[model samples]
Target: MASNNTPVSAQQPTMRRVLKMSEDEIKKQIRSTHNQTKQKLDFDPFYLFDVVKNILNPSIIVVDNIVQGKAKDMEKGNQGESSPKACFIPPCMLKRLSYEMACKVPGEEIAYETTISILRNVLSSYPWHVKAVLTLASFALDYGEFSHLADQIDSSDQLTKSLGILKQVPIVLGRQGVEKYKNSFGKLNTLIKLTLDVVECVVELEKRIDGNNTKDVPELSLAIENMSIDVFWTIITVVDCMSRICALINDKNNTQELLPFTGKITSILKSLTDQIAVCDRQIAEIKAYLKFKRDLESLQDIVEFFKKLIFVEESHNLQQATISNNELSKKTEGLRKKKVLLFFSDFDISEKVVSILKPICEEESRKDQYEIVWIPIVKNWTDIVQSKCKVNEKYFWYVVRQFSSVLGIKYVKEQWGFKDKPIVVVLSSEAKVEHKDAFHMIQTWGIEAYPFTFERERELRNREDWFGSTIDFIPDVLTWMKEEKYIFLYGGEETWIKKFEDEATKVTNDPDISSEEISIKLFNVGKTCKAKDYLGIFLKNLNKLFFSKSQKETELDTKTKEIQMLLSYMNDGEGWVVLCKGHKLVFSGNGTKVVMALKSINDGKQGLHKSTEIQVLLKQRYNEIILPVTCCKFTANTNSGWVHGDCAKCPECSQIMEMIINFKCCHKGHPTKAVP
Candidate 1:
């Protein structure tokens, strides 16, 4: 019954000495009991508290009803019958513990140290929370029964009056009723609640620790150390409450005699409440740390998978290669659950590959779904290597920090089919190879080739609508299509491009050939034009149609035929032109023929006001045109695996064309030119 008025520190030295001795003695009893038992005594302290909580803290509502002369009404409403959750502790064990604690609760005056010593010996074999629970329960039994009989002691029933008098409930309550001792009852009830809270925190701490090693967590270890003292004080408070109640029942006015014990219990309650908060924080921190550790382990597993995929020899210095960029390891976590593009190249990474991926990586909507790691194959990390890496950094929109030389050139060539040219190898989250060389697909579709698997490539091929798919990404073309304007896409060398642009401008502006209904837009989409990325994608897609593994010339579908026609015009290194109206192909021909056809249409037709009339005349003129013979060689990387056909039809004249294979090797900084 410790009160707020008496501080624990202000106690006399003699009392302090006695408390120190009591603490040591109590610990000895606990250890001796543990050794004698040799096994943990199982009990449900929380369930035991629930069974006796109301008994220890009688309802204020019931007291109010009794004072209002409505005791019968209250009794009728409260049949006192309740079905609590099943208790796991054995009935025999509970009864025995109750008897032991009841016996330990002294009736007459005794020293605080002696009372605690006697109670500790009784509860020595039990856990700290269980000991506190049992003591409170023992007091609850007597106190509850006393209150019940006292409430109905005035009844005509002789049995009730006799029991109330036998337990001295009448004297305890006084002529003024139990309200006369409300202060004492309140103090006892608060102490009981504080004791339960301490028990709950201790139980939670033990559950958190379980059988895990607390050595790594200093907070958990320190909280465990403080628990022993916290539990000891809790048991002391419970025993004092029992004594205080006994004093109240024996003689109401004699409660003053137990003031010192009450004050001690009150102080113990405050101290225990404060310590519970500390324990809670310690447990919380441990939980957070454990969660973080698990997450880190998951990320490390991914890093190791990447290392195994690229690192050829176990003796190779992974730390040196990866740690060169500290951000490499930190950002690897982003690769989890994402398709990773392992960009493998020599010191010279082709601008084609970077340009294709640059816009894809910088796309705000879908960038997070994939990651790219550049694995530069080099003999050693010399100044040349460092310089190359720095130069490539600006081009790499999403620069993955892991640029290591562990993936030697020979390994990439043998294992991944990477030739002198750079290749993008797409890997699924599990590190399984999805696409060996996804560069072709990426070059064709950009971000649409996400996951960059062969399956995705096939899916794009299956859904190909050449005219629509080609210009679907161009907003201006889409608008022109909606307006039913004639759209022309032309590509070529600089000289051919200039001639095509001049002829297209003359046809659109000249009043003699131009029609108000036939609106025309000409785009310069040459390999060296501002929109080279667009031309590159269109060429890669056209190549797929020409050299598709699943289809031949006779088996070629309508879309394939259309794409082959465009490819034929560009294969000779000549300018090419394609005309469409609202996703419908109007005409496609060699750039030279297209320019000549436009000029012919302009010279012959004057004030042509109909689009159909202009289209029919333009097609006739284009068909009648021919240019000088030139090389129609279609050069492609044989390593890309997309090239399948050795022969292809000339879509312009429907003639079979021969395919040639050539090979040449050169040292760094020198590239061999093909002999015409």
Candidate 2:
């Protein structure tokens, strides 16, 4: 078979108006050109056509037998196993059709008229696809015989050489004749292949319509509507093909005569191809809808199925979770009747958070009670996501295999109030939403925050002191807590950080300060938070803690207020410090007050005694510099799951802070500035 990739022409033009026309319009157009009474068969002619088609492109045995003077044996009985009699079609019927079709094939003088007359008179009783196939079968017979004879022209047998001369195969296969008609033979072969393709597509469409009763489907309907015009063009092109074959064999006319008909048939082939695609899509959609219906009906566990359905939309087939694609059951079977965390995010999840959660998930104590399933939400599963999934495959307790669901992402956002940030939605075995988002809880308490629920989160919040240790993600903080040391958590630009460190060193090392009674430590919160290994995940988690849905300044949960203050200091782009003495805040100040207080003590302006504790002296001086209008500003991404309240409070005095909406951008090599 010739590859369809062969171009019919440079432009590759197609029949533009045929597919767009209504059924009646197509019939009217057909009537305008070739007004002939089309044919129908009592039973499908494809059964017989298939048998004849095989003989047209016969095997080497058939070729050898035919060339060996056994051609008459084909019509009488089976010549051998490769013969047409192997099929269900009667040999006599194949003989009759081939004889009639060969007789009616158009002559060179009036090729077009004779083709139309054949369609009208002799083959008019057959269906459109049948008409096309019958003509192609007739042409294939001549093609097979001519090809075989040309192959046998140089044979040792005298009978083969004699038959080649009688058939005029030697004249066409001769050196000079070959050069003259090479392009013509190539074109005729391409047209015949293209005709076979169209006839096959037409038959396929008919079979689908009959088998599925899908003729009324819009896509298939439009395809069926255009079949008449498609079939008409195909049959005429086949006839033109036979005419070209006759001209080529007889050496009486130029094979260039088939070019115009080849172009028309190519257009018809393209039309049939496009129609088949539309029909196939419709068939697939119907199949999917039926499958979805069946799945819904067959579902034994609606809760488990609905949970699965939420993540895998209608487009994907619902099956057991495997290492290949989206499924949640098998890997999560141990977590049955327990809380399951659906970790929803885009492909860009925090590796630091994943690293922390991995050990906790693998811990034997908690393995049976809980499980986390990473459901990566994305619009399309691109290569980057695929690579990211591979990189983090072992880190997650369980993750759907290359799973991406835009609808699932939408549901997470609208129903559970998820935003640009990743969220952990907790579901009980009963499939009830235990928590809309427990991501913040996990960040705050790690494994201690087990059965991450709204009640447990509230209980944890109630237990926390307003000024307690929240930066435990850092390793040294636990040591500082054990030592009962005063830790100064501060952040600003590089210059301000250096200045505060120098001032604190001077204040702490002073002879007047009692180093034996008080231990002091300094931490650059901003710089430490952005270490490459952690990648600012600590800062994000801290921000989430502050912006959590449970956060309300008016409520007694002072940890949220402290987190708000810390984040505000970092977001302000100015030097600030908060003093924590053994996991409790002593005092907090901006650079102006904290640095000035240290300088005042260093200059002996406060008249500090030799036995005075450094932290007490520093706090007293810092308080002296405080202003009445204490403003604290915090910046957060609007889409980062921050549930907006009516107002916030100043961590300094518990005064209701005024709210203002400000948009900020921090592009590369530029300071973050607020939009006016």
Evaluate model 1: give its lDDT. Answer: 0.58
Q: Residue 562: error of model 2 in Å?
A: 3.6
Candidate 2, which ten residues in sequence have the lowest lDDT sum?
667-676
Local error of candidate 1 at residue 398 (angstroms): 8.1
Every model's TM-score: 0.38, 0.44
What do the candidate models score in CA lDDT, each in turn? 0.58, 0.59
The regions of model 2 sitting more than 4 angstroms off are 1-333, 347-350, 381-391, 395-397, 402-409, 418-421, 461-470, 473-478, 493-499, 510-515, 526-542, 549-557, 564-574, 602-617, 626-630, 642-676
For all candidates, the clash counts are: 9, 0
| Candidate 2 lDDT by residue in tens digits, 528-551 | 443443315545555555555334
Highest-scoring model, TM-score = 2
Candidate 1 local lDDT, 59-82, one digit each (tens): 333333444435444443343224
Best by lDDT: 2
